[model samples]
Target: MNIAIGCDDAAVEFKNILKDYLVSLGYEYTDYSEAPKHSSNLYADVAERVARAVASNKHERGLIVCGTGIGVSIMANKVPGIRAALCHDVFSAVRARKSNGAQIITMGSRVIGPELAKTVLKSWLDADQIDESSLPKVQRIMELEDAIQLG
Candidate 1:
């Protein structure tokens, strides 16, 4: 699957690592954050770009990274129809896709090591099918987004 990936200055290393991992796994990815390694671009901006790419179906999924992951996750989720999950562990990564049908996964560079991050990313990527029982809940989430947008 094609993946949209981005990161702020704080997570450039993590992004590079993940990009190599994606290649090793035979997945294609587009880098949304092309700024210099230590550029001042805001994490929210990168997150929005990646989130929009996925929301528009330009990419199948998105991966965003920030200092704490929280900032990017919050910003990405602000976009309509986007479910961005901040996942630091394997279980959360899997559930983000299977239970919430999240199209975007955010990682914290400061909180997770490279090996653990790879494991989390792999788990998320492998969780391609959403559980049938969670369909209604996922639908409810989309409905809520619509409700808020129409308000």
Candidate 2:
């Protein structure tokens, strides 16, 4: 899978760990990290870049990290056709992909430890491997997006 990954300064360490894990898993990915280590970078901007890549078909999936995950999730979801979920647990991570067909998963560095973050990432990736059964609901979501965007 071609995954697009990005992070703000607050989550740079966790992002590096995730990148290494992704490499270990042998998944080809694109790093959209916004800044050098310890440099302040806006989470919203990083989210926008990653989300745009997914929405544009430049990548198959996205993973963004920030202090709480909420800001990046919100910003990513603002883009049309981008389903970004802030998942902090295994169940939520699975549901984000299985139920919502979320193309992007966001994590919070301040809230979850590195080990748990890895677990969540694995859960999300595994969920994506499963057969998706929520096309009807996902279609409804797309329809809503169209309606909202058109208005």
Candidate 3:
């Protein structure tokens, strides 16, 4: 899947680390960022852009980061069709994808180290949808399919 990623100053290092992880896993991606960290950085702007990109289907998945992860997650979800989840553990990450079909995974720079972040991303990718009734968040995908006559 093609992923869109973004971060503010607080998570630049973490973003780059995760970007490398995505590359190693052979995922296509694009990034929106605040600064290079050698210079000034901003979180809000990057978050909005990343959210919009995903909302527009520029990428099917997104990863965003901020100091606490909450800021980016909250901002991304403000966009319709963008289910951005702030995940600190592997379970939440996986459940977010399976239940919500979340397009964005937001992480806190200070909350999770690179190794744990990698694990969570893998879990998110590997998880399967539980069942039709268990996936209210992704019910839209089913609704779309149900619209087809298949006749």
Candidate 4:
């Protein structure tokens, strides 16, 4: 699946490492990074763009990074149909996809090391979407989104 990736200065290093890992795994991805290390940019801007790419079907998924991952994740989730999961561990990464059908994975460079970040991304990539049993819950989430958007 093609993915959209983005990061602010705080997570540029981890983003680069993850991008290389994606390349090594033969996965295609588009970089939507705000800027390089020396530059300053908003994580929300990068997150919104990457989330939009996924929500619009321009990309299959998104990977966004910031200092704590919280800012990016919160911003990404503001877009309709974008389930951005802030994941730090392998289990959460796997469940984010398999259970919630999250289209975006947000990571924190300050909270986790590069090696662990790679592991989480790999786990997310290797996971499957929600099964029959979990479909209703995902559907409910979409329904809630719709209801909230309407009123």
Candidate 5:
């Protein structure tokens, strides 16, 4: 699957780990790592870039990371058409997509280790693998993304 990944300085270590994992899995991904590890990095801004790329319909999903994941998720969600969720556990990641149809997942560098982070990714990817066949619930929830109360 084509994935979009982004991270700030605080998430660099974890991001590097995920990068190799993604490579080994032969998953083609686009990364928005600010400053190239030379200068300072801004989590919120990088998250926004990742969200925007996903919103453009180029990639199927996105993964964002930062110190605590909260701030990055907030910033990514602020962008229209991007439903970014901060998932600290497997269940959260599942529900994020199953219930809300979130297209982006966020993780905390301080909260999860590389192994668990991989599990979270795998869980979400598993959800993506599930056939939508007659899943009205998923369709209805996903349709909410198109809803606009233009008063």
Candidate 6:
């Protein structure tokens, strides 16, 4: 699956490490950051770009990184039709996709090490199918999002 990846200056190193990991895992990804080591754009801006790409179906999923991951997760979820989850562990990563049907996962560069991040990413990527029991819950989330956007 094609993945949209981006990060702010605070997580450039983490982003690069994950990018290489993505390649090693045989996944194609598009980097939305401005530069290799430094991104002038704010975390929210990068998150929105990646989230929109996934929401529009241009990419299958998105991975965003920030200093705390919270900023990007909140920003990405602001977009309509996007469920962005801030995940710090493999279980959360898997549940983000399996339970919430999240199309985007956000990670904190400063909070997680590279190996743990890779493990989380791998688990999330492997969780391709959403649980049937969670379908109604996911639908409710989308409905709430639509209602909020419409209002």
lDDT of 1 at 7: 96
Q: Regarding lDDT, does 1 or 5 come out ahead?
A: 1
Rate residue 83 of model 5 by lDDT.
77
Q: Please provide, for model 5 over 27-117, each residue's C-alpha lDDT reduced to its tens digit, 9 standing for 90 to 100.
A: 8889887645554568877988889989999898998988899999999987777778889899988878776678999999999999999
lDDT of 6 by residue, 40-106 (tens): 4899889988998999999999999999999999999988899999999999999999999999999
What C-alpha lDDT do the candidate models reach, one value each?
A: 0.94, 0.91, 0.82, 0.92, 0.82, 0.94
Candidate 2, superposed: residue stretches over 4 Å from native: 35-40, 129-133
**Per-prediction TM-score to the true structure, in the order listed:** 0.95, 0.92, 0.82, 0.94, 0.82, 0.95
Candidate 2, residues 34-110: lDDT per residue as tens digits?
A: 65576555888899889999999999999999999999999999999999999999999998888899999999999
In angstroms, give how far residue 145 of model 2 lies from its true place. Answer: 0.3
For candidate 6, the 10 contiguous residues with the lowest summed lDDT are 32-41
Q: What is the lDDT of residue 105 in candidate 2?
A: 97
Q: Candidate 5 vs candidate 6: which has greater lDDT?
A: 6
Model 3 lDDT-worst window of ten? 142-151
Q: What is the TM-score of candidate 2?
A: 0.92
- In candidate 1 the C-alpha lDDT for residue 134 amounts to 98
Q: In model 2, what are the clashing residue pairs, if there are any?
A: none
Per-model C-alpha RMSD? 2.4, 2.9, 6.2, 2.7, 3.4, 2.5
Pitting candidate 4 against candidate 6, the one with the higher TM-score is: 6
* Model 4, span 20-50: residue lDDT tens: 9999999999998855476555888888889
Candidate 1 local lDDT, residue 58 = 98
In model 6, what lDDT does residue 62 have?
A: 97
Q: lDDT by residue for model 1 over 3-116, one digit each (tens)?
A: 999999999998999999999999999999865477556998898889989999999899999899999999999989899999999999999999999999999999999999
Off by over 4 Å in 4: 35-40
